[model samples]
Target: MLSQPPVWFILIAFIAALGPLVFFHELGHYVVARVFGVGAESFSIGFGREVAGWTDKRGTRWKVGWLPLGGYVKFVGDLNPVSMPGEEKEDLSVEQRRRAFHCRPVWQRFLIVLAGPAANFLLAILIFATFYVAYGRPETPAVIGPVIANSAADHAGLKAGDRIISINGSATRYFQDIQAVTSLRPNYSVDLVYERGSQLRRVPVRLGSEQRLDEFGQKYVVGLLGVRPPQLVYKRLSVFEAVPAACGATANVTKMMVEIIGQIVTGERSPKELGGPLRMAQVAGQRASLGWSDFVYLIALFSINLGFINLLPVPMLDGGHLALYTVEAVQRRPVSLRAQEWAFRSGLAFLLALLIFTTLNDLGSFGLWESVGRLIG
Candidate 1:
């Protein structure tokens, strides 16, 4: 048997990551629809068979589903999970038709459609803000802890304990900021502002190309400056301090995601970096073993990711609906139903293929596929 992580960790992480995240995502649609007087028939977490359920005062069925990967909300007069289903046009009671989604004003409908992704983003900000407010901010010292021998810093005479204050004349408040700048390119030169003894000094470092293996065992060449940041120390924050701190965290995460995506698009990063359910299960198992704090952090990060992914402008996603709404606002007409149908079908197929590919990657990364191959061999 492979050395797999515990089952309980896997279960908890999966539930925490997908359960509330998906629920809130769908709930965004539900709440906004209700606000616009659209009657939501059901707000469900997951797919397939229904498990536990309750009826709300508004007569909405809130239920848990068997499949735990995602969820959806069904609204009155909506033919599909999304609001774009094509059904036979039927005459409705005035009361019933009045509460239908299509009867709302364009702006109102747009807001309802936009709310799902907005909720996800809001959740991420809130989680990050809460963490920052509760524990203040944990940061590594800007002083260099170690310099790799023969690395870029070594050649530039950069030594351990040197405190970095800026890069290329730009002030850096965090060690991560320095590391990000260093990863630009091979043979690139960056001016470092640092404190040596009692004197502030500036030095130029030429980054060198080095091959590094990621967690997936895929090797890629990246520029390295070879200075390490010291361990994190918790800093206290005042009531006024938490908001900006949280905003900073959100901005940092957004920047990192943008960089990673840019690297991927430019072929500087590998496609194998994409992961799916298996990767999540593996991470959950590992984080669970670390402790509750680590697990919670992982959950928060994944929740942010969940929010980000839904905002991509793909048909069948919340962003796609927003895009359509924006176009409608500009042109003063809805897009053709035929166009939407084809687009949604294409998007669904693409997403399914992506899921399959990511699942395979995850299994390979976890050594599950390798072990199976060995057994067959």
Candidate 2:
């Protein structure tokens, strides 16, 4: 059984994990805006009161905030750090208007907003590629060691020593490929091709699933094939090979995220599986405790997740700004201030509600909610 992590350890790990990622993400925005000659009023990591800060020669106030939950780049001509538009030419001199983010062309603004998420994706690729160069990519042949009795593989006539070649038409060159295809697809039927005794055979099987709790008691479902793996293998790749492979790995992670989110939105998966800061802290601590390598890998994974989430078409996000810019591009006019305000309010409220729900879920994972209720009674 996994034991609960210490609170202080979790807190430290969470901060260590989030701080750099946040900096890199916001740095993306700041750099792109600078390239387009748009000035930033403030660049901040975290929220609320300033812990430490300084002003740069360019007149940008850089700071670390107290909350440490999220960060933002407040551009000139923005109402607040969220980047809503401020007063136009009437209140500003010619130079100020030129450097104002709102005064920039729609196309430039779109790319500037997009750069944040783009940086995240690029960071993930670089990290993965670095690992591939430093350490050989680990993989093993798709050969089954032992089939679980009365399990999906067993029911489908799969046995030990069988080599999987493909699943539903996609080649499975390695054991990792097999895992990538099946792990997110709980209870799904697929055509699996494997070589057995010099003969190729196909079998159809519905995957099995089980609910398990992590070290911190966060629950999740994962599809199972019920087959033991063979001996490990690691293949060193050249720089050229590593970069493309890294791209493929990033794409695979993004695809899995999309599929899982689709299931959750469609009610196929429990919303309770959704997690917020506390769940993140637990996982971060687990990774930190394991080793620096594992913790760094977690940072890469979370970077991709952060990129994907910010790209969602919700109001008050980078994607939301992009969406509005898209509309402005097509319609040749910006959205009305009243409409934008209404949308922002709705988005803010929805995000707050989600935060509350996920926090409650986190507390329940630790049995804190029940304990509080019992105490109240």
Candidate 3:
């Protein structure tokens, strides 16, 4: 049985994790718009009716909303909070026209839209760099340790002290890289290149897998090669050196996310693994209990996820807006209002369905259905 955190703790942790990310994301757009001389009417931390607000010196209303899951910026000359151009914009005075988002150059509008996701990626890099500078990098060689009897690694003629040089032609710099590559493709065959002394060999290995239960009673099926990594050696890096390493780490994470999404789309992985607010809250609380460093890492991870999600070319999202801008740039005209409306409607429907499904997954992960069944019996 898994011990669950108190509901209050989950709520607090979730808020602490999400609030800053949301603020920074929206702030990115707001700042860039200001740079282009576009005025914002309102800047909100969350959606829905405002809970509390005050007008800034620049006349933008800054507010906290009832819903904390997401946020937005309402630019001047926008019909509503979605940043759709107002029909009345054409009738605006010269000063109002100058400050209207839609009236800005297409390049400026594109940059403003792009800034939000860019900020999120930047945030993750900063967090990772800070951690690397503080604790030094864990350098673990990709050498095979003791092999489990009858395991895939043992049957494949892998020996102790053999160094994994690459997987399917991609170089493996660390033991972690080997684990990452193998863990995603259970029951699949991969070409493994390893070095024994001065001799290099390539062998095809069918990965093995085992079902494991976590503390929350959720099951995961991960590929197993039955080889362990040697003890980690810490290498301290200068701040300058850590910056590029941090950027590489962030890029790798983004790449892995793209690959996982592709797998899910192609039916190679289960969509049920998708999580929603409940799972996030649970994980946030658990990480917070571990330590501040753990919690900070969680925040960075979520920030990346949020940024990537927004970059999907779906209407009503930043990517969708970018798509529209691209079309506008090519055609030298904005997309028709009717087309924009339909696209936004479709996007809204898709997002809503995704939210509902992921929420259900969260409930299933928490064993809520099982608990209900037991009570009924």
Query: 1-377, model 2: which lDDT tens digit per residue?
Result: 46666889989999999998889999999999999999998999999999999999999999999999999999988999888888855798898898999888999999999999989998898888889888978778899987899878999999889999998787888898888888777788988999999999989988898787766455677787778786888887888999998898899899889988898999978888788888888889988987899999999999999999899888888888889899999999998888889888888988899889999888787689789999999
Candidate whose TM-score is highest: 3
lDDT of model number 2: 0.88
User: Considering only N, C-alpha and C atoms within 3 Å, which residue pairs clash in candidate 3?
Assistant: none
Instruction: Compare candidates 1 and 2 on TM-score and give the better one.
Output: 2
Q: What is the lDDT of residue 278 in candidate 2?
A: 86
Q: How does candidate 1 score on lDDT?
A: 0.77
Candidate 2 residue 375 C-alpha distance from true site, Å:
5.3
Weakest 10 consecutive residues, lDDT, candidate 3? 81-90
Q: Give the per-residue lDDT digits (tens) of candidate 3, residues 1-377.
A: 65767899889999999999999999999999999999999999988888999998999999999999888999989998778878566598898898999888888999999999999998999999998899987678999888899988999999999999998676788888888888888787889999999999999998999898766566799988889876776777789989998898888788879978988999999998889998999999988877799899999999999999999999999999999999999999888999999999999999999999999999988888899999999
lDDT of 1 by residue, 270-298 (tens): 77788898778767766666677777777
Model 2: how far residue 34 lies from native, Å: 1.0
Ranking by lDDT: 3, 2, 1
